[model samples]
Target chain A: MDAIRIDNLTKYYGTARKGIRGIEQVSLTVAQGEFCGFIGPNGAGKSTTIRTLLGLIRPTEGSAQVLGLDIGKDREEILARTGYLPSEAMFYPGMRVRDVLKLSADLRKKDCRREAATLCERLQLDVSRKVEELSFGNRKKAAIICALQHEPELLILDEPTSGLDPLMQRAFFEILRERNKAGVTIFLSSHVLSEVQRNCTRAAVIREGRIVACDSVEALSRTSAKRVVIHGRVDLGLLSGVRDLEETQESCSFLYSGGMKELLAVLAEGEVHDLSVSEPDLEEIFLHFYSRKQ
Target chain B: MTLIKHELRQGRISLVVWTGAIAVLLVICLLVFPEMKGEMKAISHLFGAMGSFAAAFGMDRLNFGTLTGFYAIECGNVIGLGGAFFASLIGISALAKEERDGTAEFLLTHPVSRAHVVTEKLAAVMLQVIVMNLIVLVVSLLSICAIGETVPWKELLLMHSACFLLQIELAAVCFGMSAFLRRGGFGIALGLTTVLYFLNLIANMSEKVKFFKYITPFGYCEGVDVIMNGGLDIRSIATGMLFAVLGIVAAYKMYCGKDIR
Candidate 1:
């Protein structure tokens, strides 16, 4: 069964912007225990989509179901099993990090002291300090710890790793992979394609309040382009019939969707001046695809 | 209950600060009022001005000329201001604070209904007011004994008891306005307190707008008629209370489905 099902979900603010909204008709579903990344540019309705899933905002149309329960009608029951990290970090200023964690745990009727302590240690956060006194990054760490402490079944994180350093980011990714391996579904949103490419088995690229593309990283890259950067000279005109041909003034790139037979045939006729063909990253393929329509 | 405890934890210092100031002022007034016993006319003028100030602050029902008069005036002014300010702070910020602090998403993400959240927070505001009022009463009793004044205890008790409902009702008004106001919780709560007060003032000054009192918590909370008559006016209290219930219900109704940013 799908852990989360969003069908024709739409949300709008005010009557004026009937034409445009933060999220509109955005629909997608993730199977149980699937690791999915929601890739989008800023203000492309990524956060809005996540908020609707959490039932934090009402959808103007459509609906979402988590664990076979309607999110709008059964918010508390759905939320009971969900752990969410919002785009922004927010907590009561006067509270200690430990207190905040305790409050969150208490609300969900969960005892997360041990898990919270471990998460704080892993995230390099000191829960003893008051939230208001902490630095911006530290505060974000606190929020992350709170979200993960409960060991929830579903994790919906929006821009979850923005404030982390390189070392902590890797640790966080490892934790996510470990959690996913243990049957926890993860819905993460981030601009960093490299992280998504490494961590996510499947991803959906959102643009203009819609899911423009959804597929595995390998399939998306395969469908778009593969690169063969020849440092020296190469014939551009003869590259036709190669199926996926994209050559800039200084370089030539192609998609491997055809197969190695075509590439081998092309290499045979090539002058072979320091030729190297490598798989393209999701970023390169995505950009290559999007830049065309523009 | 836990939510109310949390609010009290946040608002305890403010209540104490206001309550402390009131206690000190009460002690001083008790000391001074007795010294001017022989000079009735001058004392009456001074007390009258004090009475008007109480009215401005929301203690309109009590005259300030006699011991019972001073008691009514002090209770009216001190508790009235405290209640209005308290309600404004708690009512508006109850929901707004979650948004302001960026915790609305986090809190709402839990297995708690918006209705429950609003109800819990309002309960906390009322609890805080009741606790603060109780403290003021205790301190007033001590000061009354210390000042050694022989006064009508029944009238004094009646005048001050009216404040209990007044505080709760005003707080509820601000609570309702918190939802209605587009700006934020605190802005709406404070705005309602100030707006209703002037409305009450205008109504009291003339016969034309006396009916306006029915619409505002200020009219009943600070009305002199309840105090001067030596009994509580169930009509005004009931009206103020009706608005209070309406405010809570309205806040929940709007907030349950409202989108959080």
Candidate 2:
């Protein structure tokens, strides 16, 4: 069974204008034990989709299910099995980190003391400090502990690494990898493409409230266009699979997708001052998709 | 249950401060009652000349000579205003605090449903108001005894009960209003309570606006009316209860469907 299934889910923030889309007909599915990444720029409906899945905001239309339970009708049951970390970590002020974790366990009706202690130790979190006294990274670590202590079947994280240092982020991803190995499904939303590329097997790129691309990481990388830059004026306008072509007095650049041998032969015909060919990064690929749509 | 415990712990300081303030005011008023007892006639005539002021505050109907009458006129105002403000403050912050503190996403994503959250928060606020009223009750009883005044049990119970009901009604109204606010609602709560009190005052001062008494919770808890009639007005109490129920129902409806942005 799929861990999460959303069909034509849409949300319109009615207060803004007549048709300001929070998300428009967003549909996707994550199979059991799958690690899925949701990538988007700010205000691109990534958080909206996560919030809708958690039943924090009702959908304007369409339907969703989490862990095979209806997102609307079985929200309590779904929430019981799903753990979430919001983009901004907030806790009750004047409470110790331990107290916050304890409160979360109490609300979930679970005895998570052992797991919470283990998580705190692993994350190097100080459980004795008050929530308001903790720095942003520490607070995020505390939030991570709260979300993971209950051993939920599914973990939904939104921008979970925003406040963490590079070392802490590495540790956090390692922990998530271990959890995923233990048969826990993961849905992570982030704007950083490299982060998603490092951790997620499948990714969905959303742009302006729509999914621009959704595919496995390997397939996406294989199909992505390559960046080619040439100097010394080599292009004679005879190259196939060369689109988005640009020319200058001393250099030419374009995205190439055809055979590499033919391209090298074309480049060898000219006096090449410099040449570079590399796989496009996710940002470039994302921009390609966005520009093509326009 | 966890939510309730969290709310109680969070509200402990506010509960202590409001209860202590009201208790101190009640004690001071009870202590001053004795000095004025012998000068009742002159004081009544003095107040009588200021007809509008006397009637607006219910001093015209209550005699300052008798202990119950003095308690009705003095201690009543203290608890009435103090209790209403306390209840309003508590109720207004009950739901809005989640948003103001940026904790709505944390709480709403838990295993509990939105309806459960509303119920638990309302229960906590109501519990706080009850505890505050109970403390005031004990303080009033002890202060009256310290003054060597015989307790008029029935009238005392009636006045306290009326105050209790008034506070609950005010809390319900403010609780409903809090669902619509995204930030702390101190101003709105205080404004609503003050406006209702003044509406009750206008109802008392002018015969033309007498119908305003039915609309304000303050009208149902009139200490002079409770003292003179020896009990609460059943019809007014029923109206107050109806408003309270409607307000709570509306709050639940709005909160359950509200988008936690």
Candidate 3:
């Protein structure tokens, strides 16, 4: 069974005429034990989709199910089996990290003390310090520990690495990888393409409140259009199958989908001052998708 | 249950401060009762001459000579206003604080329903108000005993009970308001409490606005009314309870469907 299934889910804030689109008819599914990445720029409905699936915000239309349970009807039950880390982690002031974790464990009715302590130690978080006293990165570490301690079946994280240092981000992702290996399905939402590319097996790209593409990471990369930048004088009509072409006095660049050997031959004909050919990152590919309409 | 415990811990300082202030004020009011006892007749005559001012505060109906009467007039105002403010502060911030402090995402994402969140928070607020009232009751009893005054247990219980109801009613109203507020509602809660108290005052001061008494929770639990009638007004209490229930129900309805941004 799919871990999450959203059917034509849409959310609009305020009235229809003047309303802001949260997400429009967004549909996707994540199979059990799969690590899925949700990629989008800010205000692109990534968090909205996750919040809707968690039953934090009711859909304006359509519905969703998590762990095969209806999001609206079985929210508490689904939440019991799911863990979430919000984009901006916040905790009640004056509480120690241990106290926050204990409250979460108590609410889940689970004995997560050992796991909590272990996660804290692994993240190098001081559990004795008050929440207000902790720095941003430490607070995020505390939030991570809280979300993972209960051993939830599904983990939904939104921008989980924004405030972390490089070392902590590596540690955090390693922990997630370990959890994923243990059969915990993860849905990680991030604006950073490289992070998603490194961790997720499958990814969905959302733009302007719509999912423009969803595919396996390998398939996405294989089908990705290459970005070619050329310097020195070049004939404008030499290339075919090039999209998003742009030219300047000294250099030119375009997204190339044509054969590489033909493009290299064309480049060799010119006095190449400099040349660079690289597989486009998700961000560039995302821009390609977005610019396709124009 | 954990949510309740968390709320209680979070609100501990406010609870202590409010209860302490009320208790100290009540003790002071009770301590001065002995000195005023000898001049009660003169004081009563002076208040009688004040007419409208006396009526506005319900002092016209209550006897100032007896200990219970003196206690009702002096200490009742302190507890009434202080307790209402405390309850309002708690209720107004109950749900709103989670959003204002950006902690709703943490708390609401747990394995609890929105209804569960509302109920647990309301329970915590009720517990705080109850604890505050209990402290006031105990302190009042101690002060009465220290002053060598015979305990008018029935009247004392009646007055305190009425005050408790008034506090709870105000709390429910403010708690309901909290659901709709994204930022803190301290100003609104305080203003509402003050307005309601004045509404009761207007009702007492003039016959034209007597109908306002039915609308204000304070009208049902004014100390002078409780002291003179020797018990709570059953109809007024029922109306106050109905208002409290409606406010709580509205809170649940709005909060359950609310979109936490």
Go through the candidates in order and give the clash count of each.
Answer: 2, 0, 0
Best by DockQ, which number? 2
Q: For each candidate, what's the DockQ?
A: 0.67, 0.87, 0.84
Candidate 1 stretches with Cα past 4 Å from truth are A16-19, A228-278, B41-63, B180-185
Report the lDDT tens digits of candidate 1 across residue range B1-261. 556666788888887886787667767777776665557445555544665444443344444556766665555556666667775676776676676667787788888888888888888888877887787777777777887877566765665566667778777767776655544666556677777777877776656788877776666665366556657767877888897898788888877777887
Give the winner by TM-score: 1 or 3.
3
Local error of candidate 1 at residue A86 (angstroms): 1.6
lDDT of 3 by residue, A92-198 (tens): 99988888999989989899999988898889998899999988888889899989999999999999998899999999999999999999999999999899999
Give all candidate RMSDs, comma-separated. 4.1, 2.6, 2.4
* DockQ of the two-chain complex in candidate 1: 0.67
> Candidate 1 overall Cα lDDT vs. reference?
0.75
Worst 10 residues of 2 chain A by lDDT: A285-294
Q: In terms of lDDT, which candidate is stronger, 1 or 3? A: 3
Q: Which stretches of candidate 2 lie over 4 Å from their true place?
A: A15-17, A234-271
Q: Which docking band does candidate 2 fall into?
A: high
